[model samples]
Target chain A: MRPVLIMVGREFRDGLRNRRVVGTTLLMAALSLTLALLGSAPTGTVGTSALSVTVVSLSSLTIFLVPLIALLISYDAIAGEVDRGTMLLLLSYPVTRWQILTGKFIGHVCILTLATILGYGAAGVAVSFANGVAEQGAAASFAVMIGSSVLLGAAFIALGYVVSVLVLDPRTAGGIAIGLWLFFVVLYDMALLGLLIADQGKNITTGVLSVMLLANPADIYRLLNLTGFSNISTLSGMAGLSAQVMLSGTALVGALVAWIVVPLSAAGLIFARRQM
Target chain B: MTSPSVRLVGVSKHYGTLHAVAGLDLELHQAERVALVGHNGAGKSTLIKLMLGVIRPTEGHVEVLGVDPAHHAFAAVRMSMGFLPENVVFPPSMTGAEVLSFYARLKRQPVSRNRALLERVGIAAAASRPVRTYSKGMRQRLGLAQALIGEPRVLLLDEPTTGLDPASRQSFYEIVAEFGQKGTTVLLSSHVLAEIEHQADRVVMLDHGRKVADGTLSDLRRLSGFPTCIRIGLPSGVRFHPELPAGMAECRDLDERTMEIRCSDASKLDVLRYLLDAAVPLADIEIAPPSLDDIYVDILRRMAAE
Candidate 1:
């Protein structure tokens, strides 16, 4: 436990020190603010719907951005150390491979969580101030969105760890991580859209959407946030179906949670056997 | 009984068809300063990596601090060991202080002591600056500081002095010597034999992944059977006679006034008597033992001949 914390602490400090984190955070904040202001302008029905639209739009953005932040913070966690030769210094200590992996994961998770909270917090405040909905109810919705984003981010961070261990070079790992993110964030949805277009509305239903949600944690997070905002019950109502066919709240959350555990465990296994 | 800090029995490591280390046995007692010297591709790096648990041996066993480095228990062994790699490149964003503190945290110890270590290694002033700003020597010093971070009981340093300045190198050796006095067994690998000749208590010489010679410097010299060289400067007007002693294999006229003799045995008085009999007037004489380089070359030559 102590070693794990030590490793986590190191990861946290390193993340804070990284210029990439600072630059990414600033870029995210600027984009979030710009979107918040544009959505809040008093124009038409869109202006009145600004707060809802911003919340919904940023919810998707958060799904994409949170993981990007996580991967940026974590994809080089091990490979960078190996390349820099600092891994030798760290491994020379009396910490187990499991401890090192867990510690680094925890640390990265903390950083991702912090960035999500702060970046989303700023966006939420900007939208609320512009839309005049800075009350307790909106705050609660924002909290749920942020929580879901954190879970989503954790899944990606673990994925990044897997990438870090699997690839020997940081540049390659970064490219692969970003490429995977693009797949899940943009390409997966496009593929789903193509499938729906092919099915024309006859085959496109909540069951298929639920199955698609299971395939990507980012989709599940978006679906959860969407349900929180509106009465998307047709999607939620599928819960009454058989346990295996239906995606329960517990199961959706569990699958996202599994995303956090399995990849990290696999990375630990690989790292333990790695020569350096 | 206290176990050896490091022990390797018939250890061998192979990379595909190339054997990096072959059938080697070694033990490092507590506080012993052992120097590993070999030419490139001689397996010195492989041996250090095996000790650090970075690489597993293909054959035989390696125990570091009484724990098998290949097992999970190796973590405990590594916790007490410090390693300095040959070429150290740190994360560009990390400050020196942050780097040290992070390593300290990874070791699960307070880093209050690391500040002094940073200062000791002469990088305390630049602790706040990112490592990108540090020169090669500074980076090497930082590597040394990180290696000393938990006051490790066992230290494996590979080409530790690669970029250090003379003053820093001197201080670095002093620090290593102090660690040795504190009972920290140090396994240092270098191609610079003379630099470590006086510092290492035992020297292990490797050639093509095999332990060609292992003992004190003098022991290796004696084993090589390299002849000690003597230079005799004859008085300006004297010339050498045709007849020379049997043991003296080669004689070269260094100058019109001087002749140098290569003798198998320098202690014999017959060579001098023969020079005297030939009316070779000698002005000054110098006798020097074979250096480590000479002995190393002789060993390699003898092994090749065999």
Candidate 2:
């Protein structure tokens, strides 16, 4: 346990010093803050709190950006270290493979958490100040959005670690991570939408659609932050889909957690069995 | 023997049909410094990996500090073992001190000592500089410092001196020698036999994934049975051309005043007696025993012949 904590500390410090991490943090803050300011522009007439409007816009932005940021930061976690020969020296330490993976996972998740909070928190705060005062319900949904964004990022980070551990080549892992990002965040939703339109409710029922949405961590994230709350759902224009989908917010968050755990565990198992 | 700090019994590691390391046995007692020598693909690195538990052997057992390295509990033992791989690399963005401290934390050693370690490796000046700015030699020295983090009970260095200059190499050996005196079991692999021949207390030669020879230098010297060269320098004006021992020895004239004779250890006394009997004035006689390189090449040749 002590070794694992030490590893976590090292990995966290490494992430903090990393140029990519710093750049992504700044990018995340700038984009989310811009979205906040721009998103609250029309909220003056909508009568909803500025924070709730920001939540709707930020949830939409997170669906596209958070996973990309997470994958980009974590795609080379294992594969790059292995290629650089640092993995060999690391494995020679007293720490176990699972400990290394755990440390990296916790550390990367911490980075994503910091980025999501600071990046999106600044936006939330800015919108609150701009709109005088935010409603209690809107602030609650906004907080949930931030928490769920971190979950969404964590799920993708774990998936990226899986790719990193299995491939043992940073370039290949990076490519695969991008492909994963596209598949989950963009192509999967597009394909599902295409399938739904083609099926025309003849075969694809709401229940099946709900299951399909739950299959993707990004969709689950979208479902949670966009559709979980009635007020935010109405503002985000997901009220109809929210009513159609029978899944609960708890279930969506559970699926996202599962996404994180399963891939991270798989990475640990494969890493343990992998030769240095 | 203090219960052999490292022991391998009939260990084998195979990758597909290629035997990276065939069934072999080796042992290193406490405080012994053994050099592992072989050509590329000779399993020197594989053996190190097996001992380090980075890769499990396909067969047999490997025990380091009385712990089976392949088992989970070896992590505890691993804290007491240090390794420097063939092409050691550190994170380019990390400073030298950061690298040492990171490894020190991993080994559960006090990070405060890392400054001294960097100083010992002569990289104290670059301690705060990122590894990318370091020369190849400086990085190698940092790798050595990382390996020495906790003053491991067992040290394994694979081609540790590759990028080091002569002075660094000398200091590297000096540091390793200091560790050896304190009861650290050291196993280092190298392609340059002459460089480590004097530093290692014993030599283990491998070929085709199997150990061909393992013994002290003199033991291998005797086992190889290669000739020892005896150079005799006569008085500056003496013209002596003797040595017709017929198959017992071979003689060659080096210059006008020097002659060289090669004979097995068994026939060395006979050749000297014959020279004395011939009343050849021997001014200065120098006996050159077979170096580790000669014995290594001879052993490999003999193995190939077999």
Candidate 3:
């Protein structure tokens, strides 16, 4: 446990030294602030609270941005070390492979946490100040959005590690990470929409659709942030689907946690068995 | 009488159809410096990896500090072991001090000691500089410093001085020698046999993933059975010839006033006695034994022939 914590400290410091922390935090903050400031302009006409409107816009933006930043930072986590021949020396230390994996996972998740909280938090605070006061329920919904955004980033980071350990080099890992991002965040939905169109709601009921959404972490994140809050759900147009979907917010968050654990465990296993 | 610091009993590592190591048995006593000599693909690095437990042997056992490295308990044993791999690298964004401290914390050693290690490796002046700004030699020195952390009981260095300058290599060997005197078992592998010839207590040669030769320098020289050469300098323009002693001894004129005698180790003294008895005015006499390089080549050639 001491060794694992030591490893985590080193990795986190590495993230700082290499600008991974600052770069990601700034990228998230800049983008979220833009969305928060501009996307909430329609609240004046829609009669919705400015913060809830910001949540709807931010959740939509996070589904694409957070995972991209997460994958970009994590795709090379293991493969880069192997390619640089540093992993050989690192492995020769007293730490176990699982400890190394766990340390790196925690370290990277911390980076994402910092990025999501500070990034979206800046946006949330700005919107509240502009709107004169924060509503109790809307503020709670905004907090959940920030917390779940970090979870969503963690899930993708875990997926990136799965790719990092499986590949021989970072170039291949980078290519695979992008492919996974497209498949989950973009192409999977397009394919699902195609399937729904082809079925014409015959065999694919809302229940099956909800279960299928659980398969991709991105959709789970979308469900958690966009539909978990009543006011935000109405604003995001997910109110109807949220009512029909049997999964509660806890179940969705659990599924996201599972997304993080399962892939991260797989990464640890593959890393342990790796010859180098 | 104490158990060997490291022992390998019939260890073999196979990657699919290719055998990286094949039925290797070896041992290193406390404080002994064993130089692993082999060409690329000769399993030198593979053997180190097996001992480090980063890769498991397909067969047999590897024990370091009395614990099987591949076992579940080896992580504790690894605290006392240090490995410096060939072409070792660190994250470029990290300063040299940060790099050493990072490894120090991982080894559970005090980071405060890393300052002395940096100075010992002659990299203290550059300790605060990012690793990316360092030269190859500086990086190699940093690698050695990290490996020396915790004063590990077992140290494994694979081609540790490949990029070092001659002076740096000299200091590197000095550091290694210092550690060896402190009772640390060191197994260093290098293609530069001449560099380690005088440094290592014993030499182990690998060929095709098998141990082909293992012995001290003189022991290998004797086992090779190669002749020793004696060069005698005579008076200017003295082109005299003399009958050599019995046994496998050959005499030939190298040039005017110089004659060379090649004789087996057993007959070397006999030939020298004959030279003194002949009353030949000898200006100089130089005896050269078979070097490790020559012996290594001969051994490899013999293995190839077999």
Strongest candidate by TM-score: 3
Q: Which ranges of candidate 3 are over 4 A from the true structure?
A: B231-242, B251-260, B272-286
Give per-residue lDDT, candidate 3, residue B50: 90
Order of quality (DockQ): 3, 2, 1
Candidate 2, residues A1-276, lDDT tens digits: the string is 877788778778877776656777788889989988887887767668888888888898999999998898888999998998888888889888899889888888888888888888889888878788777688889889999999999999999999999899999999999999999988998999899999988999888998899899988988898888777888878899989998887888889999999999998899988877
Clash pairs for candidate 3: none
Per-residue lDDT value at A67 in model 1:
79
**RMSD of each candidate?**
3.9, 2.6, 2.1
Residue B197, model 2: lDDT of 77
User: What is the TM-score (0 to 1) of candidate 3?
Assistant: 0.95
How far out, in Å, is residue B269 in model 1? 7.6
lDDT of each prediction vs. the true structure?
0.79, 0.89, 0.90
Chain B, model 1, TM-score against the native?
A: 0.89
> In DockQ, how does model 3 score against the reference complex?
0.78
Report residue A86 deviation for candidate 1 (angstroms): 1.2
Candidate 1 Cα outliers beyond 4 Å, as residue runs = A42-49, A134-137, A199-209, A231-248, B1-3, B71-74, B91-95, B108-110, B123-130, B234-238, B241-244, B255-258, B265-286
